[model samples]
Target: MSKITIALEAAVATVIENSPKDVRQTARQRANVDRAFAGILKLIAPRIRHFIRQYGLVAHWDDAEQCCAIAVHRAIEAYDPAKAQFTTFVNWQLRGELQSLRFRLMTDQRPSAKKVEATTVSLHAITVGTEGEEASLESMIEDENALSLTESAASEQMAGDLRAVLIGRYVDHLRDVGMEQLKRAARTKRPAAQDLAKPRFKAPNHGIDPADIADMEAKLAQHVHLVERRIFDDTCLDDLEQEFGIAKERLRQTAKRAAKTIAELAAAEPRFASELNRKLPQRRRPSKAAVQPAVTIVPDQHAAHNLLTNVVAITPEAGEPLAESIDARLAATLTTLVSETLN
Candidate 1:
C-alpha cells in the first residue's frame, strides 16, 4: 500500500467514524470530510490524469475530471474496508465513469461524434436531354449494374451464412436464460444446515449437473427452431403463438429482441459487412460520341480516284479503341471529297 492508499484509508475511516445525525452537529464532521476529500483529490490527481489520457478522453478533460471527483465522493461514501482496499475500489469507479463518458461523447447521434451520419451530401438531382438522362450524386459516384451475376450469387450465399451465425448467437442468449433459471431452481432446492447434517446415502447436488445440461440442450434446440421460424422464416407472430402455445406478445417481443441482436451482429461482423456494404463499382463511363450513330459521307462519283471508292464514315472524337483508325479514314474521305468537287 502507498501513501495515497494509506491517506484514503484514514480519510474513509474519519468520515465513517465522525458521521453525525443532525445537520447542526455536522459542522465539525463536514470540515473533516472536506479536508479528507481535498487530500484524497490531491493524491489521486496523477491517477485522474492517467485515466483521461489512457481512455482518449482528453478532449472532455473537464467532464472527465468532474467524473473523477464524483467517483472519489461515491467511493468514500460506499467504501467497505473489509471488501477491498480504497485504491482498488476508487479506481474501478473512475474507470467506469470515464468509459461511460467516452461512449457518450463518441456515440453516432452527436454532431461532434465525427460519424458519417453526422455529415450531409446533397443529391443535386436533375434530368436532361432526349434520352432523359439523370444526373445526381449517386449517378456521378456509382456505376450502373455494379454487381455481376457471380457476386450477387455470392452475396445470397453469405446471407445464409450470416443467418446461421445469428441463429447461434440467439441460441446462446436463450441458453444464458436457461442457465439463470437452473441456478434459481438449484438455490430453491438447497436444504438448510440441519437438513445437510442428517446424512443420507446419496446427497443431491442442488446445482447444475449433466442431467440439467442435457435438458438445457434439448430446450435450446427448440428455441433455435422457434427463432428460425419466427425471425428468419418470417412466420407470423400469431401463428408462432398458436403453434407453440406461447403468448403472441411474448413471442413478438422475443423475436424483436432477436432481430435487434441480429442487426447488431451484422453491423459488427466483418464477413457480413463485406457482403452487405457492396460499394458501387467506379467504372469509367463511355463518352456520348462513342455511343452515337456513325455519320456516313456518300460521294456522287469515284471518277478520279479508286482510293475514294469505299463509302466513308466520319466518327467524332470519342474515347473509343478504334479512334485513330476512324480519324485516319475520316481525313482520307474529306480529302477525296474536296478533290473530287474541285475536279
Candidate 2:
C-alpha cells in the first residue's frame, strides 16, 4: 500500500517480465533490467542490514552482506505477486540467508569460526605464572626450537626414505659378496650343503641361513646409522673412516649411491622433491684461478691403421663350448640384475 512497497513490487515485476528467456536481451533491455535490480537492492538494503544484526552476525558483517544480496536476487527471480506481498517474500528470504550465515560462522571447521576463537585470546594477557611474576600467553606459546608440524613430518619422512635406501644398498652389497663366494665354490666343485653352511649373506626368500640373515641385519643397522650421520649431519668422511675403520673411498662411494638413489626417489614424489630442493644449499661457482694453452696431438696414418687392425682381429671362437656357456651365464646374470634394479 505504501509508495516504497509499491515501487519494490513494480521493480520485481519488471525483472520477471523483461528477463531474457531463450535468447540474449538487447542492450537497452539489459540496462532496464539492471536499473530495476539496482532499485530493488537499494530498497532492501536496510532490511538486509537489520536481519544481519538480528542474527548477531556482526563479526561476519561483510560475508553476511554478500549472502543477503544473493538471497534478494534469488527471491526476486522466484517471487510471485499472487502468493504474497514482495515485502513478505523478501523478509523470509533475508531471514533464511541470515540463519545460514550464522550457522556457517558457528561451524567448528570454518576458518571464520577459528578466527573468531583466535580473537577471543589476548596475547598480552597473563595466562601462566605466580601473582606478580606472570608470563603472557604469547610468551608461553612461543618456542625457538619448535618446528611446524608439516615441516617436522616431512623431515622425518625424508630421513626414513634415506634409511630405507641405505639398508637396501647394504643388502645388495651383502648379496654381491655372497654371490662371489658361491661362484668360487661352484668352480671348486664344493658340495651344495657345504656352500649353505658357510656364513654368507644371500638374497632374501632364498634359502639363506637364519643366523646369517640376523647378522646381516645387525650390520646393516649399524652401517645405516653411520651413513645417516654422514649424509644428514655433514660429518666428515675421513672421521667416519677413521672411527669405523672403513676406507674413506668406500664411504665416499656410499654417499654417491645415496645421492643417486635419493634423486630417483624424489622424482617419484613431487612434494618431497620440492622440500628437498628448497632445503638444498646452492653450489658455489668455481673461481677462475689459472689458464693454460690447449695442446693437440697429430694422428699418424700408420698408428690409426694398426689400431683398426687390432680391433678387427679380435673375434669369439665358435668352437669353444665352455666360452659359449660362460657367455650365456653372464647374460642371464645381467638380465636378473637389470630386473632387480628396475623393481
Candidate 3:
C-alpha cells in the first residue's frame, strides 16, 4: 500500500483502540487521545485552508479555519468505521460547519469586504515595502469593493424576483375564486346561499320520506341564506343584537343553537353528512364585483410622465430602474417556468 494509505489506516486503528468501551477514559488513554487529535490536526490544516480559500471565506479565514479544526476534532471523537469512511465522514462534517459559519457571517453583517480590505492593507504595510504594499492594498480593496457591489445588486434582484413570483402565483390562483365570491356577495346584498346553508341536513336514502327530505332541504337553505345575508350586510354582533332586540350574548347563543340544529339536520342527509365531516364551514363568493374598471384620469403625455415620475420617486433605491429591470427579466423567466409546469 502507499505511505499515505498506510498512515490513514494506522490513524484509524489508533483511534478505535484508544477509545474505551465505557464512556470514561483513564488519564493515560486520555493523553493518548489528545496526542492523536494533535497529529490529526497537523495532517488536516492544509486541507482546511484549501477548503476555506475555495469557498471565498478570506474575510473570516481565521474563524473558518478554527471551525474546520473543531469539525475535524468532532469527527474524530464521533468516528465509527461501521457508519462511514473516516475521510468521507470528516468532509461532510467540515462542509456543514463551514456552511453554518458562512450563513452566520452573511446574516450578522460583521464580516464585510471593506473591513477585510482595511485589515489586509494595514498588515501588508507593516510587513512589506511601502510602495508595493500601497499598490497591492489598493488593488485588493478595489476588487473587493466591486465584488461586494455585484453581490449586493444580485441579492436585491433575487429578492424582487422571488416576491413577484409569489405574488403572481398567488394572485393568479385565487383570481377567479376571489372575484366570484366578491361578485356574489355584492349583487344579492345578501351572502351566497351556500354560506348560510343549514349544516344539519343530510341526503336521505331512497326509501326515506319525501316530506322529511324536503323539510331538511328547506331548513338548510334558510340557514345558508341567513348567514350569507349577515356577512354581506356587514352585520356586526352589536347590529345583530340591535336588529333582533336581544343582548349580544343572547344573539350569539341563538346563532349557536341554530348552527347545532343545522348540523343535526345535515347529519341525517348522506350528502350533508359528508360535508359535516369537514372541519370548517364552506366559503361562498360575494354577489358584488371586487374590482372596478380603471378610470382614465390622465389625458395627456405630460400628465402620464408626471405620474410615472412620482411613482419612481416613492419607490425604494433597492427597487429602482436597474435593479427592477434585472428583477423583471428573472421574474419573466420564472413565470414562464410556472406556466409551463402548470400546463
Full-model lDDT for every candidate: 0.78, 0.76, 0.64
TM-score of candidate 2 to 2 decimals: 0.33
**Candidate 2 steric clashes:** 0
User: For candidate 2, what's the RMSD?
Assistant: 29.2
lDDT digits (tens) for residues 1-343 of candidate 2: 9988999999988888788789888888888889998999899888877888888888889999888888888898888889899988988888998888777566554577687774345688976565667799888788856668768999999888866764565556655675565455445764356465678766464544566656656776676667677877789987898888889898889878766765665555666567666766779999998887555464443665656553233355754876888999999999999999999
- Measured against the true structure, the TM-scores of the candidates, in listed sequence, are 0.32, 0.33, 0.30
* Highest lDDT against the true fold, candidate: 1
Task: Give per-residue CA lDDT, model 1, range 1-343, as digits (tens).
Answer: 8777788788778866777645454688888878877888888899999999998888889999999999887887788989999989999999988888877776654556575556444557554535677677666767666678668999989889867777776677677788888878877875545676666554354456769879889877876778789877999987898889999888888778778877776767786777668887899987666566445565446458655577656466544658777899999999999999999
Give stretches of model 2 more than 4 Å off: 108-343
How well is each residue in 1-343 modelled by candidate 3, as lDDT tens digits? 5555455556766766788887777888877877776776676667788788766688998899889978977887787777876767788888889888876666444466556553222423433345555344344545647878999999999867744443344334334444455445445564336645657454334234456446555654554444433433446788766655667776566566544544465466575567668788569867886787567854444664565553323457656877879999999999999999999
lDDT of 2 at 179: 55
Q: What C-alpha lDDT does candidate 2 achieve relative to the native structure?
A: 0.76
Candidate 1 differs from the real structure by a C-alpha RMSD in angstroms, to one decimal, of 28.5
Which pairs clash in the backbone of model 1?
none
After TM-score superposition, what is the CA distance of residue 202 in candidate 3 from its true location, in Å? 40
* Model 2, residue pairs in steric clash: none
